[model samples]
Target: MPAEQKSGAARALAELSDFSMKIARGQRMLDRVKDEHVQIATADKEIVFREDKTTLYRYKSTAERKVSVPVLVAYGQIGRYTMTDLQEDRSMLRNLLALGVDVYAVDWGSPSRSDRWLKFEDYVDVYLNDCIEFICREHGIEAINLLGICEGGVFSLCYAALNPERVKNLILTITPVDFHQDQAEGRVNHGLLNLWTRGMSDDDVDRLIEASGNLPGELTGYVFSQMTPGATLSKYNVGLLDTFDDEKKLLNFLRMEKWLADRPHHPGEAAKQLLINLYKNNEMIRGEFQLGERTVDLSDISMPVLNVYAKDDHIIPPKTTQALRDAVGTSDYQEIGLEGGHVGVFVSGKSQGVLAKGIVEWLSERDAPSARD
Candidate 1:
């Protein structure tokens, strides 16, 4: 071989070796990630209280309750409630369970072509209300506490407004109230997005729902990615490469990945109304929204309310959630600001101590009954 050609071949082999090493590092990270599944198996006594259109997982505390109140776990239709229980040690459910709170989570199952015809009213009127009634009946109690997270928080707020008599207390975490807030400043203007998204008719959304039993995770993932173009890509790149060697870090990343991909389809009409009323028109805050046959007036809720938000939340701005104090009739309301973004409010180490501690403390205060009442 020529001397120059021999040198060139040697350089090429070195470059190939470098690329191979990089690939090996990434594969090793994936292997470590898979090994640490952090299974969030609940120790509290559990039973499926209801299984129909929506399944309700009921968890009871063995510790005697000075106040035997039930907490309904309402989460977004697009994702699983397990994000609250993403890891064993980091689980909100486990924390609440240890606090001796009776818990029931509503699992909105995967919808089918037959379910495409179901409307938002069906969810509010039939499913949610039924779940409330079921819990109340099972315990022979007049009311139950409502713990709403993200979209579920919105649902719980509406439910509390509609059926004030049935709510013992309301807990809203990272719940968006005002949709008209400006998005140019890094906040998600759900109202504007809703305005644009609702242009798709209920039927149009239904077709997507019908075509795929549970809406494809890829489609939802794409929409979320589009919401923040550069930031998401950079974060994923960093997460994959930076934590490639740390076993625990890799598992945390993998768990988050699994939760992000485990999205469920939003019920067609419910999704449409969400975009139109809550996101587009900002009707919930405006007192113009109706749940089932009940006209929801936020002021109707007389129960103790604890509204929590993340200070650095871009998805739902603090201003968006801050209006709750003014909207509700309860004088015993409190607002807590935790340090983190929307997702971080529950998952991050900083928030776990601050936000979680504040929530449990707030619940404790209202746990006691007033002598006047």
Candidate 2:
């Protein structure tokens, strides 16, 4: 054979070897991995309170409690709270515990057709209020820190606004304040959901709820997947291929897939409010959003506020999250822009430390008596 042909043959052989090695690694993974081996949200915790479809948990920690006020992490119904505790090393909850911050989280359990009548008022005023009261009684503290993620941040905003005395410090992550701000600053790629929702009329939204009873998790998942179709396609192909040969990275990817597969159904009435009242009408920013009978005026949130947003967040644009700055009642409000996308703020190794450390320091500062005074 000529030199060029020999080099080509060698390259083809190298490719074949690489393919065979990947197949062997995949086989090994399939043979050894079990359901138990791919577990997530495995941090030790005890249920402190439970309602119809909501449960509040307090994580066990060996580190001495440094912040006097405990933090109650509230994530929205669209996604499970597992993202914060996706794995052992990458868990934001674990990071807080290690830093001596007493951590508690609420799990808005899976809602069914029977829960179609559930509204934002039920979540914010009734269930969330009960959780806060439970934490306050347990700690013998008048107020506990509130850390809200995504839709849960909206709940926290309403709760803190209605009962500011009960929340010592309010922290919002990837939460949209001005639902209409998606188009602001001329950023087109961000807030696909916002645009999608605005395009619908009130009748369309009502009809959707009437027909579906609840916003199905699978449908929402599909919409999100559509937002990044390229990533969705490459995720199973190129993304999975890259991790096929590495057990640790492969397991991490599987864990995230497990989390992604667990999106929860958003109750019908709440879904309507989310889509029409907030997203379409832009009520949250206008101070016209109604939770039960009372309006969720963002200005009512008078506690020390820390608004955290993903700098590259597409779902909730930085401008949307930052809108809270002018809307809130607190003069001590602060914003920390993390280096990641929406969920990346929680899972990405690069941004998780910045998130955890920022929370700890912010909470510690306001947690002190002098700072509070």
Candidate 3:
């Protein structure tokens, strides 16, 4: 071989060796991350109220409580509420606590065969209402702050609509209010959930619910994963490969993996209604959704609303959440569009500060002196 060619080949070999070393480092980091199995939602919390599968917990505060009305978080039934607190450094609840905000969360525990009959009415009017009342009575206040996530946002909207007097300021994060936007024309951004649920028939949903009693967590998890099938397929290996050399990033990734694996079974009645009425018919946004005997009118949500959503969220489209700004009855509605994906709304380091700061600023401004008295 020519002298120059030999030198080029040697350089190429050195480059390949460097990449191989990086991959090896990443593998070791992944092993450590897995073995650690870091526990999530690590902040100290006391279970303030319990109702069957539902448990409401108030996080023990380190900072003095600056806000009078404690913020109660209502999370989706599809996954663990711990997603908000996936890690200590990357936790949404911890950030709220650090901001001197009194934070509380409801754990919609995994349902059993006997919990098949749990409905939207049961969740909204019963369990959720009970939690709110508990907080209000504990604080000696008529109204408390309510923060709802995703499907829980639907419940919050309904709850605030029916019992507006109980919710001081409503905060909805990555909550999909306009279920029909995915089907609308000129919608450049849409989630696969809308596409999948639109095809589901009434009989199909009924039979599935009857057969399984509740929507199995695994099934729900699979559906969520399918939303980003390409990423789901490559996430474990590709993600670890990309971040394995960095212990911090790799460990955080594992924490997220554990949280994703902890899906909770959704109640059958609620699941059926969500599929049939909310997703398929898009009734919630149409002012036709009914919980028990009363209709859930979005206009009934008259409280000062803070709507937050991700710009690149594939799971919940921007239009889906942005719809609330105009649909709600309140003129005090404020919205901030941040750059992140669905889960990044809580987890991303850069995004968390933006999210936390926006929330604290908004809540502080609206926390009236009259509210405390």
Judged by TM-score, which candidate is best?
A: 2
Candidate 3 worst ten-residue window by lDDT:
182-191
lDDT of 3 by residue, 143-261 (tens): 98899998898889889999999999999998888887753545544577887888878888888888879888899889888777788899977876777667777778778888988
Q: What is the C-alpha lDDT of each candidate?
A: 0.73, 0.91, 0.86
- Model 2 misplaced stretches (Cα beyond 4 Å): 369-373
Task: Give the number of colliding residue pairs in candidate 3.
Answer: 1
Candidate number with the higher TM-score (1 or 3) = 3
Q: How do the residues 68-162 of candidate 2 rate in per-residue lDDT, one tens digit apiece?
A: 78899999999999999999989999999998999999999999999999999999999999999998887777888999999999999999998
Candidate 1 lands at a TM-score of 0.82
lDDT leaderboard ranking: 2, 3, 1
Q: List the residue pairs that clash in candidate 3.
A: 26-244
What TM-score against the true fold does each predicted structure earn?
Answer: 0.82, 0.96, 0.94
The lDDT of model 3 is: 0.86
Q: Please tell me which model should have the higher lDDT, number 1 or number 3.
A: 3
Candidates 2 and 3 compared: the better one by lDDT is 2
